[model samples]
Target: MSDLVSVAAIKDLLTECPICIEHFDDATRIPRRMPCCVQSICQPCLESYSGGAATLSCPMCRRRHNLPGGVKSLPKETVILKTLDYLKIQKGLHLPCTDCPDKEIAVAQCDNCGTFLCSICLSAHKRNTVSKTHTINTFDEMKGRPLQSFRRLHQCSQHQQPVQFYCYTCDKVVCVSCTVVDHKEGKGHNVVSVNEAHQGKAKSINDVLGKIEEKTKRLSETESALQKKIENIKLSMKVARDDINKIFDNLKDRLNQRRTILLSDVEGKSAENLKVTEEALDSTRLLLTKVKSSSEYMRQMRNKADKVEDLQVMGSSKASLNSMLKESPQEIPFDRTGVSFVQANVQHLQNTINVAGMVRSVTFSPTERPNGIPDTAVHNVITLEPAEFPTD
Candidate 1:
């Protein structure tokens, strides 16, 4: 579970655009590298921020960049895109076909229609007369193909025709008929063929790609370091758990030993006390028997005596009985046992138990730690907060 979460955290850090902070996708949110800072920004964010300007400032470093053609000219961050693709494949993910009602996996994409298709949908699409001439590429053939090489046509709203031209003055893509009727050059509109504008932006795009290549190399190194950090965290957790178990196991042994000593002490003293009391009880029973026997003899002699001898025997018996009765039963020695348990300092033991183990976390300096993680302190305790990644 820990490993899964850590890997997800690393992916979240690597796949997000620095500008919009959204995960990069193959469609509108595709990552594009800026020449100024060599930072990856999503395509939609660039389009919105550029706002048809001739130059755009880098969101990270604030360095101005010339948009010779438009945001479309900026090269895609191919490294990040490839990483995302590889991860998706590893996870067994499949993008759904655009034409499938039941969400079938896409096997091919139509360049002309700009829609993905499953095998069944592709067969139907090829059979349709309207789309029979459209250019389609299977997933295998599309591998490593540059995104800019694919041509997607959009229909002009006014003319309902394929847009083939760009009107710089109106800042819109227009069809040939629209250019003639509504966006003519004579009407102060600067219009140019899409090919011509693309050619003009080729040099700038190449320059950005070169910078992005270097940036991606650094990103790769950072990713490797992050992977190492995750492994380290897992190892640390395992070690801590083992330590906790060992300490508690030793404590249990000591407690059991103490308990056995206390029980033995009580049992031994109780046995000794029982022997002493039994001896005193035996002596008491013998003394009680003698007194009762003498009293009965005196009573018989007085009732049946008829001569001087009987009288003499009665007097002697009475004297002896009185002397025995005068002796106090309380004076007989019988020692009582005080064998019991006395509780130790409960609060002290409670305090010791509470502090017996601790989970500690430490923050390392920038030079000592991997990328993505910042040097943030959480004292000397474990915390459950999410890891923060640097945006710039």
Candidate 2:
């Protein structure tokens, strides 16, 4: 009896449904136990949460429970209802008599008949010859006492006698006569008192609860660590991307500068070569003019002038020819010049460009790593150098 009263105190500690945060009762707010996860939820809350689905998942544990017959198929938490009844009785709330059509408040309960009684019924029961021997206990006596002190034993379905023992093989409660006939000691059935079975199951439940708590804690920590690793991976990618951009940008700037310099050199060389060619052409043309005029004068003097005078003119023309000849047009002041582009180490430079920057992995031993470095941490390196181009 004291044990039942102590167990009833659990209602004050945890009476609310986890989903709706409402207290449970035997009526509309009845508690229903989930077979999958063994969590108790109120009937209305469970129904609404199911949302007409054939499978219902427990709100607390997320374990699925099949609803072949809907929410009604889930077992009711009778122990919780019993505790609620005890609380109501302690508070002096009215409970209806089982036999009263008007629903009169029960003043007492019959232990033998398992019926709540009004004042009038209690007197009539004592006067009845057949039921006068029935054990009767008043509710007033149960105000501060345990409800179990006046509770009736459960009747067996087949024998109609009070069940006294539990059959481990059948997982059922049976009366003494049924235990001897059906759940015998020499048979495969393991029989024990109701109290022993209760203690064993209670211990098993506590052990499982402790393990579940530890597993949940570990999983939460692992999830947080995984999230951090994902963030780190994104950060690493960004850093590598920036490095690649920087390297290519530097290479591009250097290439552009080289192009500009090469173009300028080509232009300057072309201008110098053109000036040399133009001077050579001017010198050769002047020499040609002198030679032509000197030759023509010599020919006219020889053909038309009188003997001695023509001979004198011939000497002067000869002198002019000698002077032109000394100018040597064959040896004109011209230098051979041209512009062309030649690429050096074409294959080698192409190969270098192909592998200029690469993504590489580097590992470090525990001792080689700096302090505070994670074991799973990865590093990235981007390397590039200016190519050495040959001068043209």
Candidate 3:
């Protein structure tokens, strides 16, 4: 119940060290505010500022101030530190005991020393005469509330003194002792408070972040459009392939119908010719039989009866033959109706597709198109090439 941060409190959290643009860590991020400009700077920058000087200068305002007691004299910003505490609570962090070897969780935080303590360590700390008067709070009280900003005693690289001031010209954080003993206050060096610097930089970063968000949104839309285009292309190709197959199927049906018709024609014409030839053969056989009968009758008449009987049979046969001859030709003529298929050049038909591929009727127009069509979208000849069928 005590581990929660309010929405209004969340807005007040310090997410990063303004000087380094890095996220604030409890162990490293020590928040310090200068007196002249009331600006907050990280502990590292402060330690670097008070290099060898008894006096410190505000980076933004270039205002100089005396630092009698050094970096420890810098004021603590309570609001900023409270923001850090909220962040720790957000991460569900349990304060670790400083003296514990395994980094055991601590139950209380020392206000004077800024160190967390377990029950054993807390009792020991309380019993000690030095820490007996120090203020201590349970972990529950420490969470969900703003705490005072604390600065570590970081020794300067140059004079081993705590850094107190920031140099504007050099963009370096130095100690107040360095200003007097080492770096004398020089002209053309402008300095101001960390708050003013942090505010200016935060504004600039926000502008960039806004632009990045807009670009990200636009890119997302573009990606969606591209995906739709790809799907559309796939659909069109599938439809085209289906249409091509249907066209070939129709061609095969037509060819099969043509074959059936040709076969029917051949059968009808051959049947008619066979019928005529059969009739002619029957008539000829009848005539031959009659002639043979007549000759046999004549031989019989000559041997037995007389010339009268023979003349009667021969006269009947001659009359019948004359009638048959008068009706049609002596020999039956063969009448033939030829059937053939005119097949196309198979190679030429195959090459026709290649010809279609190379052929293009393009048009260049500067005038506006009629209706709602754009001139840029217009083309004279359009050819569709379908994708290859996937094997696997």
Q: What is the C-alpha RMSD of each candidate to the true structure, in Å?
A: 44.3, 46.2, 47.9
Computed on alpha carbons, the lDDT of every model, listed in order, comes to 0.52, 0.54, 0.45
Encode model 3's per-residue lDDT on 1-392: one tens digit a residue: 12211122212244544445455554565655554322345666666666757777644233576888766576444445545554564456766687567667778777667576788899989999999998887767655553333222333578866555545455555566766654556655554433444344335433433443444344344444434433443343344345334333444443444334434443454355445545554444333333333233223222331122222223223333333223321233322211222222223534332221111111122343568776667433332222222121
Worst 10 residues of 1 by lDDT: 1-10
- Candidate 2 per-residue lDDT, tens place, 1-392, comes to 11111112223323566567689877898888655333357999888879877888766434476898888787665545555766677788888887678778888888788678899888989999988999887877778985444353366768988776777687666789888899998888898876676556445433443444444444344444434433443454445445554545555443445444544544564455445444444444434333332243233323332222222233223333433334433221221223333343323544444334333221111235567878787533322223344443
Candidate achieving higher lDDT, 1 or 3:
1
Q: Single out the weakest 10-residue window by summed lDDT for candidate 2.
A: 1-10
lDDT of 1 by residue, 66-150 (tens): 9888887886655456446544533546857878798799877787886768999999999999999998887777665543343
lDDT of candidate model 2 versus the reference:
0.54
TM-score of each: 0.33, 0.48, 0.36
Q: Name the better of 1 and 3 by TM-score.
A: 3
Task: Tell me the spans in candidate 2 whose CA falls farther than 4 Å from its real position.
Answer: 1-14, 49-54, 99-103, 110-115, 125-137, 144-153, 157-160, 177-187, 213-392
